[model samples]
Target: MKSDMSDTNNHGKEISDDAFATLIRNQFQLESLGERLQKIENETATMKDKWRRGDEAMRDFTVITITPTEFTLGTE
Candidate 1:
């Protein structure tokens, strides 16, 4: 009877161990995903900064058109 009880307790412990392993695995996966997201966020900010600077530079550009009879200057 004592051996049977010990066997039962071991079975429960095995289930608990499996659950703990799964939890650890999930935590690692979540951490990896978080790191990837952070990298992407940084890259996006850099791209946004570049785009803003390019837009500002374009804002100062002027276009001129000259024909035989007319000349036109335009800012865009």
Candidate 2:
């Protein structure tokens, strides 16, 4: 959620009438919006998978042992 890049400024760019109209039209189209939403959902699912795998790896490396006297920490 945090980005290292600064905000971008579109000061020097030029857009033709057709291109601008197409951009505006796409914003209002249901099909285009649905496709975009689907893409975002897929990306989110992929990130969650990666996080799950990382957690599993960390658990695999961690070992916690408990006894009557004290607790011990180790890696396997």
> Which candidate number has the best TM-score?
1
How do the residues 1-76 of candidate 1 rate in per-residue lDDT, one tens digit apiece? Answer: 1122234435534445555667568979999999999999999999999999988777655223345346445733
Give the CA lDDT, 0 to 100, for residue 11 in model 2.
Answer: 50
Candidate 2 ranges beyond 4 A from true positions: 1-28, 64-76
Per-prediction TM-score? 0.60, 0.47
Q: What is the lDDT of candidate 1?
A: 0.67
The candidate 1 region of ten consecutive residues with least summed lDDT is 1-10
Over the full model, what C-alpha lDDT does candidate 2 score relative to the true structure? Answer: 0.67
lDDT of 2 at 48: 100
Clashes of each: 0, 0
Check candidate 2 and list the clashing pairs: none
Model 1, position 69, has a per-residue lDDT of: 48
